[model samples]
Target chain A: MILKKLFSRRKEEYWWMTIAVPLVAILLALITGVIFIKATGRSPLKAYKLLFGSSGLFPSPYWKNHFAEMLLSSSMFISTGLAFSIAFKGGLFSIGAEGQFIVGGIVAAYFGYAEPFAGLPTILHLIIIFIMAMAAGGIWGAIAGWLKTKKGIHEVITTIMLNWIALYLIEDWLVTGPMKANISTGISGTPYISATAKLPNILPGTRLNISFIIIAAAVFFTWFLLYRTTIGFEIRAMGYTLVFGMEAPKASGVNVNRRIIQTMFISGAVASLGGSFIVLGILFQYPPVFEGGYGFDGIAVALIGQNEPVGIFLAGILIGALRTGATSVQLAHIPKTFPSIIEGLIVAFIALQELIRYLIMKLIVPKRSKSD
Target chain B: MDNTSLLNSSLTQTMDYAAPILFAALGGVMSENAGVFNIALEGIMRFAAFFGVWGAYISGTPWIGLLWGIGIGIVIGSLHAYITVKWAGDQIVSGVAINVMSMGIITYLLELIFKTTGYSPPVPYFGSSVNRIHIVFIENIPFLGAFSNLTILVWFAIILTVLMHFMLYRTVFGLRIRSVGENPYAAETLGINVVRIKWFAVIMGSIFAAFGGMALSLGTLSSFTNAMANGKGFIGLAAMIFGKWTPFGAMAASLLFASAQVIQLLLQVAASGFAKLIPLGFYLALPYILTIGALIGVVGRAVPPAADGEPYKKE
Candidate 1:
């Protein structure tokens, strides 16, 4: 009788299990963090207290500041994560987001710092930079897309290599060439964006800017595109089945090559747009390290979110909070890398947790006959 | 071209630039043949470059220090294997993890061990000069003599290529390893210990990757620097892919990419005053641009191994 009841609840419990897995992963990561703290000769409780205590991450003022900063950072992460997720969902790995992101910043910065037309207003300048940056990233991304579709070049290998090209190109041009900072010797960065191009702060004296609203708009647009558009449907179809036989489209009859290329183009544009936000909104200038490790972190965000837009946003916030709080821990005398270790543990657990659940099910679930 | 200029150009330009990538590409072939996706080649090489110089500096023997790099490569490569192969984890993630770990470890150790960050303590005679072999036959041959000032390692690379070609096509073990990559299930059904063979192939590749790293630090640069491997590992992967996963193909790709690198360096040197106009970021990005262009020309027609990144387990 209990078995019957449990079997009846199984369908509903599946959703619960999905939630349970991340919860379990988080719990396991915390446990691992304790071990890590002890191994490093720090008090785990003290560290935990600092992270969870008053004036740390959880209280009202701290929470507000933390949430606002995390939201700002999460907006950037989600944009890039969406870029990766869309490509991964379509069965293509766009590891070149880093390159696209950099190009976007370069293009945006080039425009932002350049002399505006005699009659053009600051808002117009901002718009031009945004549009140019997105277009530049899109074009950069499209090269790989075009190659993938026409020549069947794998995106993974191409993107990784392109990242280097982008890096060296930026460093060389910014440090020595036309855009080289005339004020600083041997430094590779452009001049600060025009004051008119700067993103207005939502709150006084904080880094949060108008870019957060743009990120929200982007999320909504992506969600709408994925769920409501004919092209999005075609892209998803092509993603599911690349080919069944030679020289022909399979079911849904979408042109697989065109869809793949288009998806990559959009992916690249989104990533580049994120870069523009960081440059125009946050940093106000393009520095080498300003690009940060957002690209790889996007992969983690995508995985955690299961490639869903809302899930991705939430995951990015969680990651951003961890990042912000992690620095606070460092100030509290703990090593700075503890957060990354925690994140690695979370990813490892999430990746492997399904296998563990399967084993438990196989061992514990009773076999039933159809005749019964 | 005159024989002397050709010889000088090949000696001073081509082979000098090609060694590290060629070694790394060869390692990729071995790993791919055994069904291991060797994206960690860059991380492995970087780790070796840093640690090899550290070892040489501490132990006072460059050769012994180079061997210590090989040891570190094996340890880290095996850790990658454990995560991706044994744990059934994602290969890309594992590769990324290895890269992140390598960057962190090298930076931390450089700070901890040498009390220096970004660069290492300079060891005397570290990768400074090379001895060339000039034979009467070089004068006799038209094109071959231009590459006369070839380092000992460059010769080893060419010999390794010939040896690899022989082993891959001629040996029974090579055939088995190839089969394992192609169809591990079928190979397993036929009594091959797929797991063990893969582990061996991976470890062997690690040794080569280590040598590539050592070559970077000990043969090219006198002291180690953080992120020194740059994107050589990825460039090597491009070579492997562009070479259609064959040793000769990889060598050709490596040489082509290295030639581009040499050209970029030469251009940078020749026009240092006009550097800003050149868009150096784009120049440093030449290998990627060229590789993509080349791959786009040929990738659609080629085929990789059936189970390149898929982990296998005996159910």
Candidate 2:
């Protein structure tokens, strides 16, 4: 009864809850890593170093390559993270970023090698491909949004089903049939993209390309649109009120269906750009088994960052750095999957924030509130 | 072969594929009936697939593997129940966490135990011919021959479907679960133990999902691959929705979805010219496409339990 009374007082819960969520997440992740690191017969200190060495925090000899890898991978994460964050802000859990990314990659890769675009100026060719990829991706994302808005089908089911469709469409149909490269070797992929369509490498001897610059601009654009604009306000409002069933809340300045579609469009375009970077910057062509991992991981990045633009950028870097570091840790005889465990634990802790708040409230508020 | 034999082969294959999906759809039905939205069915199946293999590998007994699968299901189910029921956690977030963790954890465990990355070596399995239940009378029957040489796991799946149908529609416990799902406060007022009921439903649901995973590894194949249970769990979820969350309905849905695979295989075997006319990807994507179509067709018509996915707290 005392616990129930303490819990009923909402103000007390938020006081410690704000401080505890992030603190507990980090602590729990650290404990998990330490336990697994110990299981591998390694000291936690060295294991952390090896695991984080890819972030270039330590002045190791191969730090340059490691750091560059972290930055390059982070560009993809940040872009996809932005994709998830935007839709999330619009009160939609759209996991179609995976499919959107593939759509963009397929478009970008195709246009990069298309015959009609041959001998065009580098900038013009790149511009055409970029626009095409974004359009393709936007359409892909909008399909789920359209289904949700018009057909009343849930976005989660549609997005997951779309993901599988995209996977098979690319792998089993397109790559194997129409778009299969005209090469005799066993390699299953499209033809190499022309150098003119590629994103120029920014750092010397590193894979870090102008993709990072593009993603940085995207981050700013997302922040500006979300925080400063009227459209963004309506989107955020829609999230809070979730007035999708209503035709249009004109008084509240929100068109629910239109906002849903627009949010998904922007989210898909951003995620598609992330995938295009792989084609234009790294792969230079779509691989047959371009089965995406980063796209799905974007959900984690978005949630971990709490769906904020800057938070996504930071979380992207953290996850990208860990992914890069996992290989080095694997060489040290530790399970590379340890990072995933930490990622899962972090999300789990965040999901259980309410329970954490209740426990913290019980500890800190019960005695003080007893007088009431 | 001849037409009857061809039809029989397709029927048998359909049954093989449908069993796993049926098991998972049944799991979803049970949990959702008690007001828990358990998307972690996929993750539970993945974890169970690996543990089933590990258990069998260590003990040289498939029974131990089945036990292992059930044990892990109970443990993961409790974790999910604790988060969603006890703490009022976001169901989607918790489900995503379990899935992501399962992907990495299973891969790591596979390497640690088997010293292989892609798949485990073949072990004692239920799918092996000697372990199959041979119904002598049905052995020579044409279409019925499909059920003649079936594994114990497949029989369990078919039996459980009927059991679940009866359990959900005919029993008082089923009514209580449905009532709790519909209105937890009302059920509480009627002296029903909502928490305990939710816990039981979730755990049983997870065990059913684990059975699906076992069907993937131990029932269909003698080995556990990293890709075991692939998108089958999600497909099962689709079946659950398409079936409108009933056991017999889910069974019909699973069979319908699984028939796509059967048709694809049959098409390949029948005429090379015709099979080549259609892209292989179409066959592969048929079930998913059907899923979306089915969902779109049924939207707003098939309603869920009134209080489904809502956290119930005492006033």
Candidate 3:
């Protein structure tokens, strides 16, 4: 009876925790941004007003172009964020998400323009693109996973290597060479994908499209897979090896090696879907230069969101808003890079959050608490 | 095909590319040798490259810039050590945090100082002709001519490799350092101060990485771009693994990777016909492809230092 009560209470605690981590991080980031602006001899309030329109703070101005950009990017961020969170849950540091994202985009772009699966129904065409792109990403991710499980090679190094490989082979070479649009305009990018393959805009007068709905499904699918399945149980069991030292999981009959590869495959597929979203929903074509650091942003988002699927969805929107605000910081006569400083600071703070909380409680709050 | 010129370029330019990678790889060797999972070499190099340029621009000396780079490396390294070592935090998280912070912080400072986001102003740098140690007589020699007219930084890399090899393999203190990396508890029992060794190793690792950053800005380009030290640090990390975590082994691996890079350029320029028939991406992606292949089979299970990324705590 006591054990049941304890388990039930633990479940309840996560509801509050889902909100707390991002709240504290966002709060700390805003405070730091304010100090930085103040140090530069500018009114923090004025700069912020120019930053987030209707700067009253709930991430507003949904009718504007910026809000549309934020919503679109949030969809992208949430997708990649799911990738990282799933991989982390399986005890893999999969930085290959960037590469997987790129691969997925290219593969989707290829299928988007290619006529091999042509004349099919629109929904069928979309399904084919999703499968092909996600499979490409999965295969790419599995390389690193296989290296880790079979050869004891570090996944981080291999994944980084794979990222560079994708950059050179796919992004730089193939896209600019064979896949280049034949238009005499001399632009270096893949041909525009078919209109039938493109996701129709859902939000009238804004770029927001079917990606918003699709990404929501992805989050729900990942949450269900992680929390409501036996495979997820095995994956979580492997993850706990970080604390239990790899022995408990091994002894508990979890196939550690298989779990690593499976988890990374799922992670890679999700990241690739992010690429598909951009290609299908936003760009409708693969450009020569996609410096979208969405994969890296996923790392920050996953950490800030405490790795819950729903939490990641919220964190993605928050970060996407910051990114939109950053692009417009120039109107306030502040450098756009300023918002990036806050993003980086938030990551840095979370990495050492334990120490920060300790310092605050002991150094700043002790006197007031003692009086109470 | 201009075969001789291609061969000459590949042989000579190898060290030029290899020198920075060698410096960064040695940095990996130092820190991981002490069991600190220091993957912040890329971030440290980024910071140092910019600071070095600023220092040189102000003082009109690459040497002073190098000093500034070292100073910042010390601060960054100490920050890393504090979080991962002193605080017993997650090593990967700390490293990732530092890497993330460096990207924004450097860009912010670059805009603040230079009033430009693209690249810094050209400054006094060792890569200039006046500073190079020209081995004039070697020009008459066949392959040996490739080593002529190199920067002092290149020589530093070569010398440091030898010194690291000797220190790591031939000394008692080196044994203790390796022992700590392998098992800090065992080292502590043997009276070695695990924290002190870790501190020394992590700090020195940063200093070496700072030198690599200097090689990029102060040695090669004489100016720091926002893209300075692009992926060199990670390549160095790959070199450390490919070398099986030894000084001389890392030097060899750096040379091989550098040669691959040089061959790509040679193929692009000299073998244009071949380049067109195939694709430029094949050459550009060669090094990374080679890394994946090497990790898969050639190296055959390169194990890290036993206690590599663990945050050790005393009982």
Which is the leading candidate under DockQ?
2
Which regions of candidate 3 fall more than 4 Å away from where they truly are?
A1-22, A40-43, A54-64, A116-120, A184-187, A242-247, A359-372, B1-9, B272-275
Report the poorest 10 consecutive residues by lDDT, candidate 1 chain A. Answer: A242-251
Model 3's lDDT to the true fold? 0.82
Models ranked on DockQ:
2, 3, 1
Model 1 residue A282 lDDT score: 79
Sort the candidates on lDDT, descending order.
Answer: 2, 3, 1
Error of 2 at B225 (Å): 0.9
Candidate 2's residue-wise lDDT over A30-92, tens digit each? 788688767856678876888887655456788888888888888898988899889988878
- Better candidate number, 1 or 3, judged by DockQ: 3
The number of residue pairs in model 1 that clash at the backbone is 10
Per-residue C-alpha lDDT of model 1 across residues A51-79, encoded as one tens digit per residue: 55422246755666665676677777887
Q: lDDT tens digits, residues B1-315, model 3? A: 355544555676788899888898999999999998777888888889999999999999998999999999999999888877787766766776677677777887787789888699999899898988888877646687767878899989999999998888899989988998999999999899999999899899989998988889998889999887887987888788778889988898899888878767766776755457777788789888776776677676777788888887776
TM-score of each: 0.84, 0.91, 0.91
Off by over 4 Å in 1: A1-13, A16-57, A60-67, A114-127, A174-188, A242-251, A288-292, A304-306, A325-372, B1-13, B123-156, B270-283, B296-300, B313-315
**How good is the docking of model 2, as DockQ?**
0.61
